[model samples]
Target: MATPGTLVLAGTPIGRVEDASPRLARELAEADVVAAEDTRRLKRLTTELGVTVGGRIVSYFEGNESQRTPALLEELEAGRRVLLVTDAGMPSVSDPGYRLVAAAVAADVPVTTVPGPSAVLAALAVSGLPVDRFCFEGFLPRKQGERARRLAALAGEERTMVFFEAPHRTEAALAAMAEAWGDDRAAAVCRELTKTHEEVRRGPLAELAAWASDGVRGEVTVVVAGAGPEPGVAADDDSLRAAVDEREAAGMTRKEAIVEVARSAGVPRRVVYNLVHSKGPR
Candidate 1:
């Protein structure tokens, strides 16, 4: 019996086609089965590389990933080398290859990766911010309330945060970030990375928010400075009570308002509520 073939997750260039590794070209031409997130894009890539795919080409994207994983795994089990490629960057990083990779691992199939261009690292490197302790947040939630809640949770995070956002919603997201993270905090908005119109704008969150209000085009990534040292404010009973009252007056339910104030003030929500109703809402 022939040994089972390996499952290869290959990375494609984020923008420039010349950035594709030679090994990626060879693997694309030689694999027994080629699974691509966008087959049309793969065809274009193969045309650029001047290589003809000798293997079977299948579409594997977000919509079909769940249904396609089993089929791909069967080919790998049958000793067919399966190469997975995404439209840009590595497959499975906020892309459509995780299900297949998980299936391959669960079936005891060997899997490997071909490192290639990554917008995440590229944006971080050029952001003029500290990279040693940075975190990738992928993308923010789309809904206004959900996005605000997500940002609220990160208010106390110390690691610099990176995020991807659509051009259309960049202004709203940045504005919401400013409201949650403070207007004066520093950030960078890196756009059209690795492309001809690449641009990086760095400034206070409020300023970026205002700039984005007019609009921004192309792909975008944002890097934000982490929450700086805690402010020298006392989180005493009186202060906590005052904050809860402020939020409650602004429209949040009493419970919701307490949590919001506690998070922003860097104190426990329960501690604030206890201070408010020590003998139960007089």
Candidate 2:
């Protein structure tokens, strides 16, 4: 009988390589096999850290993930420790690793992690938005109509929203967000975070949209303020839905309209939300 090897999901620095942990270095040097999102990036990181990888290096990116997962899982079942690292951040975050992790878990292989810097948390921390609760909406749909529908669906999302966008699409994303979340809504655009030229532009969605219109660069993370209801507004079942529609048409977030309507009508936010969004007869 042999012990099943452990699978390590290691986190890498989003930008500044110095943020890589000592534990990551140790794991990189000692693992029996390494599955990297970008083998080239992993090479650079190892060179910078002055650590020579003793493991069998394997490419495991989105393109080859489905094909490569089984090979890695075989190593795990063979009692060979496998380490997984993405180009940046933890694996499985809009990145590779989920498939392999799932396979390993299903096989009852031990799974562990090496925590490191994360752009999501770093951006959220500096976003200046309410961080008590937040959701990570990884890259939006590229098409205009699809993106619009996605943003519209989240119109009632009150928890601060965090999104990753390409530099080229930053302007469009901001513009869509402004239309959906309202131009007056506060937001922060974080670019090249933790690296030289890192910039955090905080302002209303309209302002950010205009600023990005000139073009932006590097990795982009956009954080938007959550919608809250206005102080005075009324709500009945029909009125609630109507109120949200009116405010949304006027560029207020659906959640903001709901909150305002509930407060004025002396109703709970959830009750108001159900009335506004429920499809069946109320």
Candidate 3:
């Protein structure tokens, strides 16, 4: 019986060839099968790193991952270590490699990772946003309605939010964020991290959107400050009720709305509930 092999999810450098780690080079040279999102890019990376891959290289991207996964699994079952590398950063993070990893685990094949550079982490580290707690939102939907709905759901997310955006869509995405999360919401647009011409712009969502309007370039990652304090805590009862009303309009029940309102306002639920019941719409 052939011993089952290991599946390694290796991270490639997002930019700058030197960012490639020695361990990554070693893995590329040692793996029995190298599955790459873009074989051309993989070749370029190997050449730049001065490392020759000692294995068969195959394309394993979105278009053919389904058909290719079974074949890759066969190699693993036959005791061939399979190394998965995306074009940039880590695999399965808004990239290919997730399905194979899931399959490997199901077959009891050992799966490990060679952690390296990540654009998401790189953007976050340099964005200067609060990172004690944050969520990686990957990419927004291309459809405007779907994108708006997605942003709406995150409207109340208190944790810092991270997102990837293509250079072309960067401006539009920022505009949509401004509309959904409030134009005054704090945000940073990180472009081309770790590469020459890298730029990070920090300001309110509206300001960032307007700045990108002139046509920004390069890969983009956006970090937006979470929703700030709930609306109008210092205002009268009518204002508190209005905040709850907005949440309820978004499909939250009265109790749920009250809880969220109070949490955001940093006040007790009882205070919000009292005001909500006493308020008359102005």
- Note the Cα lDDT for every prediction shown: 0.86, 0.86, 0.87
| Model 3 quality (TM-score) | 0.81
**Top-down TM-score ranking:** 3, 2, 1
Q: How close is each model in CA RMSD to the real structure? A: 10.1, 8.8, 9.0
Candidate 3 regions with alpha-carbon error over 4 angstroms: 229-282
Judging by lDDT, tell me the better candidate of 1 and 2: 2
Q: Write the per-residue lDDT of candidate 2 for residues 12-123, one digit (tens) a residue.
A: 9888888989999999999999999888999999999999999999999999999999999999999999999999998999899999999999999999999988889999
lDDT of 3 by residue, 1-282 (tens): 799999999999888888988999999999999999999999999999999999999999999999999999999999999999999999999999889999999999999999999988887888766777889999999999999999999988988899999888999999999888766666789988889998999876778999999998888899987765533443356667888889899999998888666655544567778887765553
Q: What is the lDDT of candidate 1?
A: 0.86
Q: Could you say which candidate leads in TM-score? A: 3
| Winner by TM-score between candidate 2 and candidate 1 | 2
